[model samples]
Target: MYIESFVEYNYIGEIAGLLLSGLLLFVMLYVRPKKTLLFKYIFNGTILSIVAILFQISIIKVANNPDQYYNKNLFGIQLISFLLVYNGILYCIFSYVNMMSVVRRNQRKEFILMYAVLSIIYVIGIIIEIAASGLYTFTLDGIDIRHFTRYYISAGIVCAVVCFIASALNRREISRITWHAVCLFVPTSLVVLIGQMIYVVKAHYIFSATTYVPIFMIGFLLFHNVPYDELSGTQSIYALDAYLMKNMGKKKIWVVYVILKTLDIENFIKKDIDSLYYGISICRNLENLSPSLRLYKMSDNKFVNILEESDPGKAKLIIQEIRGIFDKSRVDLDVPFNYTIIAGELRSETDTILKVRQFFEFISKRFIDHNSSQFYITKESDYKGFSEHYEISSVIRDIRLRENLDDERIVVYAQPIYSVGTGSFKSAEALMRLKVGDKLISPEVFIPIAESSGAIHMLTCIILNKVCRAIGSFSEYYDFDAISINCSSKELSMENLNRDFMEIIERYDIDPSKIRLEVTETAMFENYERANKNMESLSSEGIQFYLDDFGTGYSSLERVMNCPFKTIKFDKTLLYKSLHDDRMNDILSYMIEVFKKNGFITLIEGVEDESQKTYSVDRGFDYIQGYLYAKPTPIEEVKKFFNRKSSF
Candidate 1:
């Protein structure tokens, strides 16, 4: 070969080597590089290849001809060439071992032995080159003629063996480019293997290209997808988002919500798990029918969407289907998972991403606030103004931080519970007040925020503590009967709810019987087993139990039969609607009678005037709780309430 053509031919080889070396480094970055002894060889191997390229360039650019300046440096160039080949092989060896680190069983052992054998074959090829081509020769240059034979032929053979070994380690992940290289290299490596029967350098170049396929593919793969390490299969939430984005573009987007019953799962497995796949299955079930709906994982427990194609009627239908799945489940937890999400079709799109995210944030907050049961949706405008008020709400939060802050920001108020026969105030339900400095804010203003941020527990504790303390103090002055405190279902999970209540009652020396606990149907179902147990213990110690909003929330006759409650407070639904609706009247009559026969107390709620009052009196309610007696009042005003009823 002529000098210029010789340099040009090998330069292509040098470029291939450089790219492969760079790719090897790139792949190693995410593969969790261990500070191993072999990586040192791999590093040196790849580095010296750069020196070989520099030596070639210097020979072409700085030297005149073979017999001129470069001839004296032939030994140096030759050594550099040896180092490049040496390092390239070492890199392949290291990468193969690193790649196979995760392999299991005897296959891993077999792989290690195969690489060891390939290394031995490389040594034998070097010995063949030494014997076949003289070890050194020079035409104005002292050169190892055999080195070229060994370097090209030996590497080609090693590559073919390694390629076979590496191909066997294939995983058909769409994200892996090594597999792509195997496809390209395997045939070429075989051709090179056939060509090696006759020792010719020209034939060696064709096989050499095949041998370097992995390095080229690897370098290219560095710029592309890396499976599991650099990039992994979508996380549950991310997968949900990707699916939604892909399917639904600008349209009435709808979401498929899933609730996971992971309690048993968490108990069964101790290791960290990517549970997104199971969650995706839930979306898959929903999409199996309503294939076009967009979805996104709002959180671990919730996913949502607001496609441009969605309508309220269609949204409702999708929600019902998802719910029917849970409703029919034979295993309770599998049916009703820990997460209950509301998927609202977003109708509030504007021109901005911030608006979109704000809309999503608003959607998520309202969805979580929905609390109980089933996949569902609501219009964005219904909640838009509600969140809009938060512009002024932040200032109120600072006011809430003041001394006796909660009390200063909130006024404690109570609504009287009436004994129907006696026409007297028997007990009061404590409600929170949010005040801006001197102005009182309604419970509706902050309870949702408190609940969402997990501040509800602290707020609940404070309110209950104050109510108990005040009633205890009030008892010292007057013969106050008793007080009722509303508890969220979440409160039942307090580490020692029984002990906390016991301590409060014990601290004030208040009779546990004098303290009644009211829980709404909205909150009654969760922690039912633990709640009922706690209530039983409290009742055993003398506390009273009242099931609030009885006509609502899991309100089947089943709860009346299954739940342990001394009293049922019929929801405003029953009392307000009973007058005109005969069916409601009949149901109310049936409910009152069912409780009466069971010796359960019935409290009619939401009576406003004589018309509703007359209906409650006719309905056989043991008691009533509503605005008819008086709205929730301050402690100072309780005296006036009792005095107004003094004539009784």
Candidate 2:
């Protein structure tokens, strides 16, 4: 059957497309953020498209010079080239869908197997088309038009339909860039399909489909693939934020936050490559645990997994499995490593990316403070704890911003310290109390949050100012030697700590001698140089520094002696344990003697009963502070203890 073939091939347009696609390929490879697995797939598709375009250009060249290559079986070669071009275009479409599946983390074994089957069928069809059509009839009118069978056309339609179905099924996972590319692709593809049908009816050559390959490649590079950590190959925190914002109300997500504490130490010691390898290994193992898990590396030591899970129980089970993975890794590795995992179901109805990030920080701080391996915010009570922490953080932020001591949200209480030598209440420790509505939030609960959030310095300054006020107000009537204020490690490391403290004490016209700063052994050890400098500068101004929570930290006696501390406050745990164990009692006595010999005033806190206080006094402790003398109370309530002396 002969027909009037009017469709003409545009060699110039085809060549322009080939050049543009090649340039885009160069740009993609040169400027890609990372050579991720997804990038490799897209890169392969681009290369295939470029090859297809080259084949189309070669066929056009051969057809134009028909007489020059007449003996080359030109028609058969053109037919094979046409099929190969369509095959490349179809593979590109499949690759786009595969990248989307990768982002969604829903690429299951079944999906992969189906893809493999479709690919095999498509390739086999190409082979069959070539074998079945060794020679094709052609009319060498103006342009050498090949009259081919409908095998390639039919196979292309079926493959295109399969790709369309696969893409539709994962439409939700398609990124904005992919959607835009699809929007452009649909109209172009329709035009190509309509033109191909027209060409077939008119017995003309079909145009190449590689013209728009660069569009998809550019879109994928610019909009689709998110930035990932170079070391761990996990998405960045910014990507997580974007993902959360994009999928907020669309699906239920549970975040499994993992922190490798040992890896953090490793990173500090410049073993970053090894730490990242360990982190990447953990991520791979976690990804293997679930098909719908997407991991993001939030920081050096922290990883976040977004699980598409609706049930809290199931999420907890997954988290437990994750903990087991970490535990097993610790046991399997040559070096011992410790890890913490905290998982909580995201409230899609009300949670924002910021809130989710804050939730992560809150739980991380809780884990560090409690030293627990795993935590699941699956229960209402657990969420309530988070809510309380959020509220307390808000209160602290308000206090810091307002700088109003009269707000009453932040209150200060004083616990009296009894002097064993003079047998009188000679000193008091200023403690922080946060009044949230009617109930008081414990320091144990909010202190770590404050420290983690960088609000501890503000809290420290407020407490110092309030204590100075109290000392100035009650010193006329009270006979206390000094009021001790607790300083956190974060506060001690502050470069402006001395300036902030001196300003407050100077403002109230209180003697620096009347203000004693209580620092934990851990705090001093955290940034020894800065803490020591701050302590020495403050001590030189007549403010005594007390090494608080002595036995709770790892500090050598020589280090403690070199520190500019006037006193050592033994922790309650040491006192309680020493009372029960005779060996501990001897060690405690020896420590007190050593400190006293070095001209350090020694105090044993947690002296509750008569026996404990008597043991403390007999051991020659200079001071005692505990519940047995006086529980922490308001500055006004502590006045009665000023004149009272310990019976012991």
Query: Which one wins on TM-score?
Result: 2
User: Once superposed on the true structure, which residue ranges of model 1 sit more than 4 Å away at CA?
Assistant: 1-361, 364-410, 435-449, 493-495, 555-564, 643-648
lDDT of each: 0.55, 0.71
What TM-score do all the candidates reach, one by one? 0.51, 0.65
Candidate 2 worst ten-residue window by lDDT: 140-149
Tell me the deviation in Å of residue 116 in model 2.
Answer: 21
Model 2 misplacement above 4 A: 1-34, 37-215, 218-224, 227-350, 354-377, 397-407, 474-479, 636-648
lDDT at 140 for candidate 2?
38
RMSD of 2: 9.0
TM-score of 2: 0.65
Task: Report residue 152 deviation for candidate 1 (angstroms).
Answer: 6.7
lDDT of 1 by residue, 468-549 (tens): 7776666655544677777777776566788877876787677778788887776757766787788777889988888888
Which lDDT tens digits does candidate 2 get at residues 506-564? 99998899999999988877899998999899989999989999999999998999999
